[model samples]
Target: MYANPAATNRFTVNAFLNNDQFACVDGYRLEDTVTEVTTPTNQPLPFVFNATDDHAAADALRTLSHSEPGDEPGQKWPAEIRSLNIGDVVQVTAPDGTVTHLAVDTVGYIEIETVGAAARPAVHPHTHA
Candidate 1:
């Protein structure tokens, strides 16, 4: 849910209990006409990652740690691309403890292991820094 920053509004939350509280078919109610369950009160929120370098060749692609290209997922292959994926905003932590945020728009697959002679020549220039 989002609210407009330019608008000024007021809201209120109210509750009433008939006999201290109400109960539902599920469990006890903290308030009237409500029910409470004793499943798991503490649940961890999932992390939303916009980008990830969790590939098997992450070590070989370390040079892309700070590089950002306008890449998107499911698009036609570009002339020069390393690795890519489409996801939510990814929080990146640099070696110096600085955090960076980026939105992954695309995912790419580069077959570095099965490069033919022609493909190998084109990819050799990009494999190195």
Candidate 2:
């Protein structure tokens, strides 16, 4: 059994059985247990949507700080982040032409999708949980 390292709200550990059994961080094993199974070693972290202050969120607008469809080489981030990691707040351009801000939810050496691209207002999903 293994637990997601990035899973918050619990500190001890968690185990998900192959047959739909679950164990809480506090070690309460769920009924209808199943045998252990091998999980992919490369499983990614879960998405943790977050929020930010109005002034701060507005200030982290990426499009305004850099890039206009295209920017000079290395002057701007690639389609994916080249130097940022989880817990870091960054700016992103939405598909609807909105310049939004988001806090990274999954740390990795490469691009990871388990992050909120939009800085949801009024919901601090990360810190609160």
Candidate 3:
């Protein structure tokens, strides 16, 4: 059974190192709802990112990462990392006052992998230093 899209969980993405705002993609559903996982090597404990195929939402993510193109020519991108790192955390607050945190192990995209499929170039998920 599919849950109501409107009742979907809210997520707040932020950098693990500095707690800086990364991106806020609202009403996004997870492909799998497993909150935590343990790998064989115990490296990255990635969570699924089944983001809605919304152009504005994608742009917001790109802008937060400083990957969005500037308005003027010869403009330089911000000095911050242009993608989320492996250790980045995604925090989810429940209506019951419980909080869940997921760490970035591997990043994945939904419905925006192809060229010209998105409003701007789709930012591939990456790990930063």
Candidate 4:
């Protein structure tokens, strides 16, 4: 019941057991998790996003990262965040100078994702620098 067996033997780890972590997403992550939602679909997901080019993005990131379940995730944004479920494309510039753009997608944490998706988009453009 395994895919590869070269290392760790299924011990790869992160915040949650059997999970993985990353310092950045396309190197643009300026930034989850209860089973609060019981929806059968993943459509119209909630998300808060901002480019790393501004201070507001950093603020939004801080608010989101520090938020916990049962807390108002959307109420703490820094006004530079965006909420969209259309899976719009986001561009991120890696620290190594590589640029990549990807449509919004999530790995897990539906509950928190819902909160972010429902948050309001900022009044300005959120594309990264």
List all candidate RMSDs to the true structure: 26.5, 19.8, 15.8, 18.4
Q: Compose the digit string of candidate 2's lDDT tens values, residues 102-125.
A: 333332211213235422222222
**Top-scoring candidate (lDDT):** 3
Model 3 Cα RMSD, Å?
15.8
Kindly list the per-residue Cα lDDT of model 3 for residues 29-85, writing each as its tens digit: 232221111223433332222234332223333344455553222233334434544
TM-score of each predicted structure versus truth: 0.20, 0.21, 0.27, 0.23
Candidates arranged by lDDT, highest first: 3, 2, 4, 1
Worst 10 residues of 1 by lDDT: 9-18
The lDDT for every candidate, in the order shown, is: 0.23, 0.26, 0.32, 0.25
Q: Give me the candidate number with maximum TM-score.
A: 3
The residue pairs in collision within model 3 are none
Question: Across residues 1-129, which tens digit of lDDT does each residue of candidate 4 receive?
Answer: 774432222110001111013312331121211111111241222223323332222223333434422112333322222332222233223333333333233431221122333221221222322
Cand. 4 TM to true fold: 0.23
| Candidate 1 residue runs with Cα over 4 Å from true position | 1-87, 107-129
Tell how far residue 44 is off in model 1, in angstroms: 6.8
Better of 2 and 3 by TM-score: 3
Off by over 4 Å in 4: 1-81, 84-86, 106-129
